[model samples]
Target: MNILVMMKVTFSTEEEITIEQGEIVQEGISLILNPYDEYALEQAVQVKEVYGGEVTVLSVGPKRYEDTLRTALAMGADRMVLIDDPALMGDEWIVSQAISAFAKKERFDLIFGGQMSIDYASAQMGPRVAVELGIPIVTTILEFTMDGQCAVVHRDMDGYMEKLRVPLPALFTTQQGLNEPRYPTLQNRMRARKKPIVYYIGEDLDFSHEDRQVKTVSQEFFVAPRRSEGKILHGSLADQVKELCDFLRFAIQ
Candidate 1:
């Protein structure tokens, strides 16, 4: 089996984040693998362990994203690929395009990814890639098992659950209840640093920045306004209602 895991590098919320000049400042910011993506990687590694196959982790991001790829390698992905193309970095759709291009380059029997990245939480990349490849996709999968060339999947639907039997060469976006992610061991870390990561740029993939422009643009970045303390009214029921009405009228005025 040839399995592919789509992963992402995200800023660690443990560290303070600051916006400057209409952009997020990278300085003093800590980066790590997206937590949800880690679950996908763990499931891929588990599949490779049970079945005889190679697992490859891939990402579309800047050069610094290699760090997160290395971390994935340490977690048990057999190989890593990074598309460090600044021009191609636009929106979730552009990233999905680049990933679809890479998928076309290499044939994969199964593709796994997180339901959404922590940064954007759009949850569109996996579905977009599946559409571009014309393959079936199942999102928010909680459990997955292989039988021959087909997959037995269990996923959450709103508050209920659904089971499916999807064929091979399909994409799946993992949810939190899928599985627990394992930490890299000391030995794995040593070997991961020595692993070579395949790198590519936008031109190599025949992707033009102008054609891959982001449809949604961020106008500005500002913290959510702080919430004010709640006001309490104490008196007889009628008196409390009258006081609330008075307060509302005064505020509206």
Candidate 2:
């Protein structure tokens, strides 16, 4: 019942973001584990309670991300695998490739991740990795259970329910509606404080390609305008449908 959870550590909203030479200037910014990844981590921990096997937390990012994985360890994953490869920094395809390659090497029976990383909302990374491994990918899984070598999962697709069963060694990237993640208990937090945080460097992994070819570079990074905080579209089911249909009709016309 070995499971692997992929996580990302990101900058908090309170931290100021800047851009220098096209790359995000995150120096001195406070970093935290991706909120969405916490849901995946929570689910994996719950499964650990029943199945009873090692839960390995893995992440591919800059050297600074070790602080983030330590946080996941505090939450209760059994082991950690850090792919310290410089080439993987901020490149989604390479990150997915290197991670999937590493995960396959570990022979984990199940791999779970968040729907997408917060810093980059490209939701295709998980599925893309699964494709690289030639495995089935069930995304947006709200609920799932392991039965022998099979997995029964509940998925939501545009207000419709989708029940699916896939073979073992599959990939799942989930949304937040799946379950509520619990906070680290006092004792666990204390233990986590004493836990060892291992550091790995770029030369550790087998790196074949380093795409140094750059087509363009950015000069700055700025936040987008936040939409209205409230103003529900419509509360009633009928009103919601009417609003949606009217919007669609207007859009088509």
**Winning candidate number (TM-score):** 1
* Candidate 1, residue 27: how far the Cα is off, in Å: 2.2
lDDT of 2 by residue, 1-253 (tens): 8898988888886877876666677788889888888889999998899988888888877777776567788898877777775656545766776677677567888888999878778786788889988889999899988878999999998999999999988989888888898877778777766776544444444545453222334455666777877545767999988988888899799
Which residue pairs of candidate 2 clash? 22-218
All models: lDDT?
0.89, 0.79
Cα lDDT of model 1 by residue, 1-253, tens digit: 8999999888997876678887878766888998989999999999999997999998988887776679899999999999888866778878888999889889999999999998889999899999999999999999999998999999988888899999989999998989999989989999999999999887777776565787777788766677999999998999999999999999999
Best by lDDT: 1
Task: Provide C-alpha RMSD values for all models, in order.
Answer: 2.3, 6.4
Count the clashes in each prediction.
0, 1
Structure candidate 1, residue pairs in collision: none
